[model samples]
Target: MPDAPLTQVLAPDVSPRPSACPGLWRIVTARDGGICRIKLPGGVLLADQADAVADAAERFAGGVIEATNRGNLQVRGIGADHHGLLDALLAAGLGPREAAGDDVRNLMLSPLAGLDPLMLLDVRPLAAQLLRMLETTPRLHELSAKFAVQLDGGEGLAMLEHPHDLWLSAVRLEQRTWLAFGLAGCPAQQRALGAVPVEQGLALVRAVLERFLDLARPEQSRMRHLLDTCPADAFVAGLGLAIRRDAAVLAWRRPASRAKWLGVLPQRQGLALGVAPPLGRLTPAMLRGAARLAREAGDGSLRLSPWQSLLLPGFDSARAHEGLAELAALGLLCSAGQPLARLVACTGSRGCAKAQADTKADAVVLAGLLHQGGPGSVHLSGCPRSCAVAHVAPATLLARAPGRYDLYLRDARLPGFGVLRATDLTPEEAGALLDLPTEHLDD
Candidate 1:
């Protein structure tokens, strides 16, 4: 367990390497207020815990809660009562097992880890072990707060674009399950660096982390940084594990999941309902209502998604539609076809000093304009930080001023929000151009 109250251990001056990111212990100040991030295990939140979070947001903060793109929840606009908020959340069992563990517990699993109808292996058990090691091992706690690991079960509803420090994808070789892994990238963008037998996955992870800590300099906080200097082959050679770098594993690619995150989601045994609070911000009332609905109509748990949405798993298939209506009434986007469902926006000038424009408000306007054209995913960023979406969006509206934006279309050959299509256009103008066929954009 953590040695002392997180409030004491986490004073800004105490950390050997202080992080700007918000955690349970470190409530970073922002333009709006202090932000306290609460990480969820495999993105699961119990119904009771949901209500507690809602209460804490209303009682101790400004009642604004955000579902992060990484499948976590953060309380925004926190006031002086940081202790009161932490106490409430800890009481609800939201804090990591050890207070020092809070920042290191960044293991991402598919939102439908065990429940997905199309999964190669159930990764929940392995994820549990990995999370425990990350928390209980004091040596591993030295890792950066942003260092993350992803364990993919080959679920059809998985988020494949978000890069991680270390990622493992399930694969079958001669009818035997194996884990193909890559460093510093997502499965979709990069080929597997190597493969290990399923049972050897844990040992491989431990060795890789230890190796990284040994070789990485202070400036090389992420895997990509280290890889820039040290060859990946040399790093793998020292692992001392029998890795399969054979053609079969090297040529393997993860199939793209075109599955919609919102609406009635098919499950292995039952059904799940996916929902998103508007612009990734949840009101206290909306949260409490979702909790009440979870308790009454579905399983007593909710799962957060990388899409900045929530999922109510284990719901009765017959009653899933009813739950969808209830969720919609609570102001959640409950369908794939909803215009707002395809838009992601960061907290702009309203809450972030770095922002030049109100991205959230702009996103709302863009959504209305895109309503007639059908659903197309877009990201609105107030700055280059791009806090809202980890993966690149199909189209990006980079804000230059209060209402002007530079639009970029996703292109494989181009980097950083893709190729720039237009410079300094209003949302309405961008909408008109985006409405045209893809071939017309280049002209």
Candidate 2:
């Protein structure tokens, strides 16, 4: 249950322009038909909204709704009725306040942002503010749909490896709370370029975005792309703002978050439940059931995690097991150590033309062959686009052809799915090698 009904909300009279990315209004044409990506706020979607999405998918487009790796929803196989589909979603209060603001709303927070017991800060307020800035500011519309930001509240359940164009983390120096800001990399790996007082968050974001737009060419879509040409230090030095780089702020680093994503997560006040649809594909029933559970047992809202799961926060911890039981009934993977939890697969030949193998169908066979969870996470991509995951997974099984793959292990010395461990292995061979429970693959 969100604070208010996102009811028939039309983001004032604005028409979104055409782009490669999909939006409520600008449905991008795909091999299937059209694609519409619904960006959930903090990845929170209400039960009513879920129902609305389901209805829209069934009536106005093809019934194939996809749960994106970034925790948003995308509907594929759209027919000629794209406008009708957009209207249905907008009527459900799923569209942005400004049509231009749709793609710019890429901000990721931990699913348990406000509720996580081990969090240093509750990021709800700042997240809301930053979202507003990106939405209402007309200049930000010039940014690419792929230009994204991350806000780490220091929650134990945070996703830290995903690279962001602009990142901010909660940090304490001396006796005061400040936000450490960086550009072109994730908060976990890159050192903070500067810090700003918590109160200046809006101004800080404005400055960084303005600087990015000011310097970047249209061809450079992402911050990292621009940074490739312009040195990070030169880019930072050009920002005409007072940035604090003292030992107190610069000496800090974003600490590691607990990797447990699916299960009952403890909250400061009560409890929150995290669950994922297997391989992130949800039947309409599964979506509706989770939404109903969120409304009845927890807060009236559901937060979607970057791990391709959904969370219901503010539930009574005493009733957690009861809620967990209900979630399990919805065909969601709740337990962390489950074999399917560690395996990720893209929409292979079943959905995309470039795919040689049906990765989703093959993932099922591979999961059964593996028989158990291992020390690392594995991504099975049809091609190398790696749509199911944004960050480099601990292990990658890149499909070469039908039932054949190239296995890559997580190696610090390499990039893009890490070191190539083996090639041209059958699914059984991959399972034999990946089933080993050795040292932790990633910290």
Task: Give each model's whole-structure lDDT.
Answer: 0.87, 0.81
* Count of residue pairs whose backbone atoms collide, per candidate: 0, 3
User: lDDT tens string, model 2, 1-443?
Assistant: 55332223543223454466777656776667777889987888887999888888888776777778777898888888665777678778896745788879999888888878877778889999998888998999888888888888888988888889999998887777788998888977889988988888778888889988998888888888888998887887777777888887777889887658777777888878888888877777778888888888888778888888888888767778988888888788887667777788987886778887878887777777664555567889999888788888888899999999999887767878888889998888888888776563532
lDDT of 1 by residue, 414-443 (tens): 878888889999988977776665652321
- Name the lDDT of candidate 1: 0.87
**TM-score attained by model 1:** 0.95
lDDT of 2: 0.81
Off by over 4 Å in 2: 1-17, 440-443
Per-model TM-score, in order, reads 0.95, 0.93
